[model samples]
Target: MKIKHLTRALILGALLSITGAMSSCEKQTQTQAQAQDGQYVKKGEGALSNVMLATIQSAAYTPTLPTKATIIESPSNVLSPRTENDNQNQINAAITNLSNSGGGTVLLGSGIFRIKSPIILKSNVRLKGGGQDVSIIKRDESWTNVEGRGMLESGGYIEDLTISDLSIDGNRPESYRMSNQFPLFGIEITIDNGGTTRNNRVYITNVKIVNTGMGCHIKHTNNVILKGNYIVGNGTLASSTHSLPTFFHNVYLRSIDKAWVYGTNYFKDSPGGNGLNITHLTNLTVEDNIMTGNNFRGIRLGGSSSIILVRGNTVSSNTDFGIGLAYDETGQPQNFSIIDNTVNNNDNNGIYIPNNTKNGEVQGNSLSGNSPLNIKKGTNLTNVSCQAN
Candidate 1:
């Protein structure tokens, strides 16, 4: 009886030990899981949570965020003899000084500066005016021969500046008379300087380019925004050279990325000359713009790839089709979208989509006041959506 009792005691002890071990292992597993859950929650909140919380707390107590505007210094009053213009030296000096000080705004007081040469803008330098009409940069006809006299040619990084309320007259009155001389119109604003990887930006707003050649010539640029400007090409020149005409649609934009032309007006006549002509570009957006009195189509695209969005624009009184999509030398427009545009009173078809064009979407545009709703030339056209008259 004593031996059996001992055996029973031993068995009971072993069972108790096993249960204790299992319980301890389970407890350890649960603790490790709890620790991992806590770590995940902390990591999910991110490292900036403390800073964001502090900022919110401060904002709740403060009335407004502190802010201030910096006013740039002006150069000494000096005049340039070549252009017979006041503030030419001052303007150059001010721009240089602004560039040296990282970046700042260079204000042009109310006056006309007869610029004989093109002004080079530095990185972060803003050449601004009091208003578009008040501050004018008139072109000196004699100085047009200078190497770089094409109004404002920007190669540096420019941002947050207004180059508007100014006038650029190419002053070539003699070349306007020849009908065959279609290339004499000079460029108002030329960008990129044909440099590689020059990411320059410009805001040309509330200005007028009258009786001059190409309004704003953008070449080899990226992220250019042309807005709220009036470009009228109605001048008669005596002899036409290789230069584009005053109203010639020579807004040359080649090899550009992510460009936008919005809320502006262009009047011109020709195949390459229109309100907006994009070539060899990717990711273009032409929105809320008005192209009237154009001799050719309003918007023309050639040699462009990727999705080009044309929305909320007005194209009227054009002698040719409202929109023309022609393939490049190789005959391919990879993808395009034309939506919600108001095209009316055009002499030819409202929208011309050729046979070589592929992967285009045309929808929700008003074409009743014009000709046929959609015109397709080739077999490769796909994903086209339109409401006919």
Candidate 2:
């Protein structure tokens, strides 16, 4: 009996030891699984990771304007001075000297200064004024031949300048009497020549441009913001013999890579003109603008391509179509969006998108006092919602 009791105690002890070993193995397996699942904390930060984080943070902020600016003030004379009779050379010399030194502001004091020749602007220069009503730059018709030569030329980086509160009158003899008689405007601002420097990152605000063959001309530029400016076509009263209709465009943009024209007012009493003429551009945004009584189309985008956004603009009393877009020779206008615009009282169709255009979205545009058809002859048009008001 004693031997049997001793054997039962030994068997119970062996069973208990086996159960304890199994529990220890299970705990070890759980710890190994957690390690395999990447549950460890990081010890040090990486250089590449920190750099990427810093780049993202910096990109979120708006860039600040340049610190130094040059001021160009007009001679103190209430009456307009002729380019030949007045100290025109002195003024041009001052402008050239300041721009060559570095980019700074050129202040125009209160007066009317008649400019016979086009004034050139170097890189990083700002032409400012005391007040829009106080300062004026009038063009002499005799010097109109220099229209395309550019009133301001930029060599290096041109950015962050306010050009407003001044009037540019283009009714002088040198400006008006042209042999070619083409649609040439008063001021030409351009950025070209494959320079590393970008051109015309300028803010044109609250200026009145009157009697100009074309008010403001921009070419080969980027990030040009035009706001709160009044652009009017030259009236027929300027010409007596020809009886030719007034040919003026409030703003003409040609071959610009990326541009925006917003919150501007354009009006023309005579016919055969455009409010805004855009040609050969990409990534253009036109919004919150008013175009009225234009003889030609309100906004004409000629042979442009890639990501054109026209939104929240008002087109009224235009003799031709309100908005017109044409494909380039290569048929390249792929993506265009026209949304939330009020187009009324146009003689022709409200919106005309030709068959050559592809991948367009026309939505939430209102049409009134004209034909019911807002869109015409376009393929691959999706999500288009047009309603008559």
For 50-166, candidate 1 gives per-residue lDDT tens digits of 121100001011111111123244432333233456435567777777777776767666767776566765555656666666677766665545323356665445443346556
Off by over 4 Å in 1: 1-83, 144-149, 155-162, 174-195, 234-250, 264-272, 369-377
What C-alpha lDDT, on a 0 to 100 scale, does residue 110 get in candidate 1?
A: 70
**lDDT (0 to 1) per candidate:** 0.55, 0.57
Q: What lDDT is reached at residue 288 by model 2?
A: 86
In model 2, what is the error at residue 117, expressed in angstroms?
0.7
Q: Where does candidate 2 stray beyond 4 Å?
A: 1-88, 141-162, 172-184, 191-200, 234-248, 267-271, 371-374, 378-389
lDDT of 1 at 20: 47
Give the TM-score (vs. native) of candidate 2.
0.67
For model 2, how does the per-residue alpha-carbon lDDT over 214-331 read when each residue is reduced to its tens digit? 6777776666767777777632223324433444466777776667677655544324567887777777778888887876778887765556777788987877788878666755
lDDT of 1 at 156: 49
